[model samples]
Target: MPTPNPAALDFLQTRRSRPAKTLCAPVPDRATLEMLLTTAARTPDHGKLEPWRFIVLGKGAMPRLAKIAEERGQALDLEAEQIAKGRAQFDQGHLAVAVIEVQRPSPKIPALEQTYSAGAVCLALLNAALAAGWGANWLSGWPSHDRGFMQAALGLEDHERIAGLIHIGTETSAPPERPRPDISTITEWVET
Candidate 1:
């Protein structure tokens, strides 16, 4: 029989992402963040090709990125509300890890699998942060998707893109539980 880990199972069942705006200062220190990243890097890669990299954006970097977001939004002719929504994450972020999806040329593994690996890394990192007692939220906005904004703010290469920006900080308040999807409706059991 497989050994059961009730705590891990329980945590997964109850885990909730803290809102980025509700996250405050006192973000994880370098050592703690490093440990979390180490944990996140253990995500499954089909071809053993680590097709993701992390860029740690400290508090000092937020303002600079915020400015870039504002400029890029204006240049794109985005409405004020949309621009503000895009900039809000950076403006409020205490610390974030930018998960960059670096598409590696692989013969055995397809590009789509590599992209899936990158996405898994993002979720792993977010879960790792939350498990380590930090408030964490995964965010991607118009700025993250806009090529010009990405190039100016993060220097992403042609083969790389932003998978997610995981904001980590102390929780100012616990978010109330929201509605959850009905698993019965979403799940399908198959016997072939």
Candidate 2:
């Protein structure tokens, strides 16, 4: 027999990400945000490499980041719409945690596992925020993928890259639930 956590399972099934644009003011305070980050840091890491870190972008940093996005977009010869789209997340974000994947020198553990661990941290942070009653969304736009943008915005090292930006804020509206994927289509079981 196996012990079951019905509530946790139910929450996972019902979890939905709120749109970044729809999140409003009164974001989580520093102490609260720290708790979420702590929860996120608990994600599994092979060999304890801990190849990730978090950069918390507060309200004051948004404008600067948005400007950087615009400048980077221009430098990259990106279209106007793409530039706006890149800037919009920062423009509307109250607070966001930039989950940075920091690749470490490891002979035993592969780099891909570190990346997967970083991604897991991002999701853990998002879920932590949501569970704490804050509306949250994980976003990564073209700017996040641009090396120049990463350097300009956060002074990331060559080995560091953005895994995600998990935005957390007050919920302005309850978004309607969207369709979910059927487990049968995505899951496979093997007995060998």
Candidate 3:
């Protein structure tokens, strides 16, 4: 007989994502973080190509990533605030995992599929952290889209790119619930 997991269902129904900027210190330890990474790795990958990877940037790597983000932002002529926002995830982060979308050359599996899989991994990581009693958020600012930043910060290869940065830590304050889309209006029924 299988045991019921009502808590899991309940949590899913009410789970909300805390903003990365609002997250603070006391991040999850290495062993605990590994659990979240393990959960994230289970994302759906078409043809088992596994066209994605993750870079766990703990406390030690934040300064380096921040420095690179600032430099890249300056080169792009971004405003001071814009540059700061790009580097905020690292500058104030306790822990983060960068989801990298790797496009593999495959005749069967399409590149879009790989991209979707990487996005799934990001969500998985965020949900896993929340489930583990840690506040988490998925963030992607200009740094995530900047090629120079990706190459320098995360050491991305030509075929790989940033999908998202999952920031996990304690919530400094509770996030107010925002309005959600009307599901009925968005859903379409298929009938012959």
Tell me the spans in candidate 1 whose CA falls farther than 4 Å from its real position: none
Residue runs of model 2 more than 4 Å from their true location after superposition: none
TM per candidate: 0.98, 0.98, 0.94
Give a tens-digit lDDT track for model 1, residues 53-152.
9999999999999999999999999999999999999999999999999999988999899889999999999999999999999999899999998799
Per-model clash counts, in order, read: 0, 0, 0
User: Model 3's lDDT to the true fold?
Assistant: 0.91
The residue pairs that clash in candidate 3, if any, are none
Clashing pairs in 2: none
Tens digits of per-residue lDDT for model 3, 54-153: 8989889999999999999999999999998888788989888999999999999989998999999999899999999899999998999999999888
Which stretch of 10 consecutive residues in model 2 shows the poorest summed lDDT?
A: 7-16
Comparing 2 and 3 on lDDT, the stronger one: 2
- Model 3 worst lDDT run, 10 consecutive residues: 86-95
